[model samples]
Target: MRRALLAITGLAAGTTALVVLKGTPGVTQVAQDRPVAEAPVAPGGSAAPAPTPVRSAAPSAPASAKPSAKAGVSRSPGAKSSTGARSTTAALKATTSAPKPANRTVTGPVVSYKYGSLQVRITLNGTRIVDATALGMPQSGQSGLRSDDVQARYSGTAGEVVAKQSANLNTVSGATYTSDAYRQSLQAAIDRA
Candidate 1:
């Protein structure tokens, strides 16, 4: 009886040790080679098989879906054309065709004067010149009166007696013709005044 009890105890201990070492009941013996089941289709409907995942080895475009060369369809959102050809020339022409030319009439008398090479037009409000503007002068090149013209005009009452005393400002280097034309225009305005 004692030997029988010892044998049964040893068997129980060995089984417990094996269970402990192998983790949970269904974990170690779980099947890895089982086939995946398909999702159930709805009743009364005919459906296509699921598409295969796109593979990197396959070409970017499918053989059956070729686009025409003349078609302006862009494959990528921001991809530039290799030839740099504009696609919508007619659309650009249609939009730009309706724009009218700008108005160029002087609202008041345009008093013109020459200060050296710079020609300036003074817009008059009756006898008083409201604003002096440099017209027909190159922005970057040497083609207008220098800072001295502005100073002389402001220091004297050229704005007040714009009609009576047609003043010519001293020109900077290479701006004499522009100033002369401006002075002549201002003299014409003064003569009109």
Candidate 2:
């Protein structure tokens, strides 16, 4: 029994020592594998000069790790330097952007209604209508008031004309004649565009 107890104690101590020894090397390997940027620096401010010397001695590690570090250093300067990279990006943007069709104005023939005659001018960006403006609208008495209402609802960039992208618009409540004439003129302008 005495010999068995001694044997068991010896085995336990040997196991504990082996574990300590194995764990230490693993920790040192992990520290060595960490990136230079994450390596702990001495608090004495002499750490900067230390890395310069270490980098100069490329053969300190196995041949495998050195080639990769050298390749990374060589590739990074070409890939990330500001002048070359910026020009490449700018060239790519220029080619991709090119130029789009310019905006143009198309004027429609005047349409005569019972109140008066009104004409429309539309600004188009390529095939899309961007704005509508009434060039001539009734401006006397009750017809003028109705024309004003129609113009407010159907003209400019935010108007129903651009929003609907067509002459098919809802009639202003009390401006039937003005709305009809406006629609006709707007339709003509779209056709001309």
Candidate 3:
């Protein structure tokens, strides 16, 4: 019984030592014998597998200097392409410059609603509502109003107003009172702009 226990303990210790040693630093070169999983075909077409880098003794050459044989286009990095010779890697320069828009902020009047008074300042950049900040949110007085929750719910609606470029926004769930107040204040700011 003593000999059997010692042999079992020895085998377990050896196994534990091997597992620890196998995981510690230097043992990564072992090729995985796992079966290659089928790669999904891309919607565009059959996509090429990403190239794996191999350790090499020779000095690496510049990617741009190495011209692709299949594609007739040869691209020169950082420099413009020559006439009659097409480049697949060429970047187009912008033909026209967009004028810089003036930043304007329109403050809305505090709309006294059933819940509380709410006011907002709407910042605009060329008709686009950049930001909407609630100047006066619903106060926690008679009603058990949470400012944070109201702000969080109204935030999504405010973002939609900016994205849609209109005050016509959907009311957030569980925050109808705040949403209504926000809409009126936002519309006022929009009209001011």
Best by lDDT, which number? 2
How many residue pairs clash in model 2?
Answer: 0
Number of backbone-clashing residue pairs for each candidate, in the order shown: 20, 0, 0
**Model 2 — TM-score against the truth?**
0.57
Per-model TM-score versus the true fold: 0.27, 0.57, 0.45
Give the Cα lDDT of each candidate.
0.40, 0.70, 0.57
Which pairs of residues collide in candidate 2? none
Mind giving the per-residue lDDT tens digits that candidate 1 earns over 66-158? 333423232222224448754343333565575544322222233333433333455554455555554444444332234345434432334
The worst-scoring run of ten residues by lDDT in candidate 1 lies at 50-59
Residues 1-193, candidate 2, lDDT per residue (tens digit)? 9667666655554544343334322135455455667655545654421111111222233322213222212211113444345533344356667588899999999999999999999999989999889977978799989999999999999999999999999999999988999999989988887
Error of 1 at 149 (Å): 6.7
Residue 63 lDDT, candidate 3, scale 0-100 = 26
Give lDDT for model 3.
Answer: 0.57
Q: Which 10-residue window in model 2 sums to the lowest lDDT?
A: 48-57
Which residue runs of candidate 2 sit more than 4 Å off their true CA positions? Answer: 1-87
Error of 1 at 117 (Å): 9.9
Return whichever of 1 and 2 wins on TM-score.
Answer: 2
